[model samples]
Target: MTRFSANLGFLWQDRPLPDAIRAAKAAGFDAVECHWPYATAPGEVVAALAETGLPILGLNTRRGDIEAGENGLSALVGREDEARAAIDEALAYAAHVKAANVHVMAGFAQGQAAHRRFVAALRYACDQEAKRGISILIEPLNHYDAPGYFLATTDQAAEIIAEVGAPNLKLMFDCYHVQLMEGDLTHRLERLRPIIGHIQFAGVPDRGPPDAGEVSYAHVFKAIERLGYKAPLGAEYKPGGPTDDTLAWMAAYRP
Candidate 1:
């Protein structure tokens, strides 16, 4: 059976992170993940997860200086210090919360210099967090949603993972971005199965609930199961209305 993880970042934006964790549990989600939870005290999040018994799958590194239009820091050529700081902060927070993975964000950058910087930062992260048994994730953002983003395709992410040469380093295969950037989801999933650390999905183009989308998640879910991916897939979609109102799709996946 396919299990699901509510992405607290978009699922319950109106509530506190702790409250969102509770909501995900109540909503029958198997687990939960978030974008940036730095503002919320790790103790609060830890307490909520303890109360609900829902494991947090992962959380993202802070997007540096949002006001300056910087999406992430690790890939920018001149921001090595800031990038390492973000990585350190994320790994520490993940450890405190008992989370399993950290999605290292690669900011808006391009060129060989950016590539080298990103690889070095990822190496630092993988080395630092390996002792804790935490996996480091890198996701490819679609060009339409994240222009100039350094990592923009599965091929690129796979190549970088190879270059970094870390067992704990893996790819975050978000279906929405992959479908948008490179069609053929099933084949890609098969080809990249070994390196896939996590998977996420949303309605393409709209980024809404998965019930209505260009890609059929029902079929995709079957493919994922066949690929032997046992983790709960992340439901990282916008609700369009109250998140509760958008959960009708969950019934189809439940017993």
Candidate 2:
């Protein structure tokens, strides 16, 4: 059965982290994925997951120095130490919370320097996480929403993943970003299925809930099923209205 992971980052912002976990379970989500869960106590998050019997599928590495305007550190030239430290911290937290994946944010970077740093960061994280049975994910944010983001296309991500050549390294395929960056979602989904560790979706352009989107997720979901993907599809979208009001799509998507 297909399952969905509520992205607490964009959903349930009105509440605390634990409360958001409970809200996701109540909303019929089988699992939850958060942007950065470090602010709340790990014990509290663990307790919530235990109570709800839902897995925390994944969380992200901290976006580096928000106050300094660094979206992330992993790909920044001359920040290898900071990037590795971030990876270590994220891996430790993921281990504590029993999370299966960690999305290593690439930040705003460009050219060869950034790419080299990104690969080095990933290699270090993959080696560190493999022993714990965890996977490392890299996502490509579309240029429209994230202008200077280091990664912006599936082909680019695939190339980097190939270069890294780590068993634990994989792509975080976001359908909305993919559609926005390059249309033909189904073909890309099928073509890139091997290297993809997790999949996410949202309404294109607006970044809203999945129900009203240029891409027909009905067919997309069918293609995912046909391709035999085993992981849950991450719902990482901003709610157009109340989060609850935006979930009519769940009734049909839930197992």
Top candidate on lDDT is 1
Clashes of 2: 0
- Give the CA lDDT, 0 to 100, for residue 1 in model 2: 70
Query: Where's the lowest-lDDT run of ten residues in candidate 2?
Result: 246-255
lDDT value, residue 97 of candidate 2: 95
Please identify model 2 stretches exceeding 4 Å from their true place: none
The residue pairs that clash in candidate 1, if any, are none
Residues 1-255, model 1: lDDT tens digits: 899999998998999999999999999999999999999999999999999999999999999999988889999998999999999999999999999999999999999999999999999999999778789999999999899999999999999999999999999999999999998999999999999999999998799999897988899999999999999999999998899999989998655
Q: Per-candidate RMSD vs. true structure?
A: 0.6, 1.1
Error of 1 at 97 (Å): 0.3
How far residue 240's Cα lies from its native spot in candidate 2, in Å, is: 3.1
Q: Candidate 1, which segments miss by more than 4 Å at Cα?
A: none
lDDT for position 47 in model 2: 99
Once model 2 is optimally superposed onto the true structure by TM-score, how far is the C-alpha of residue 8 displaced, in angstroms? 0.4
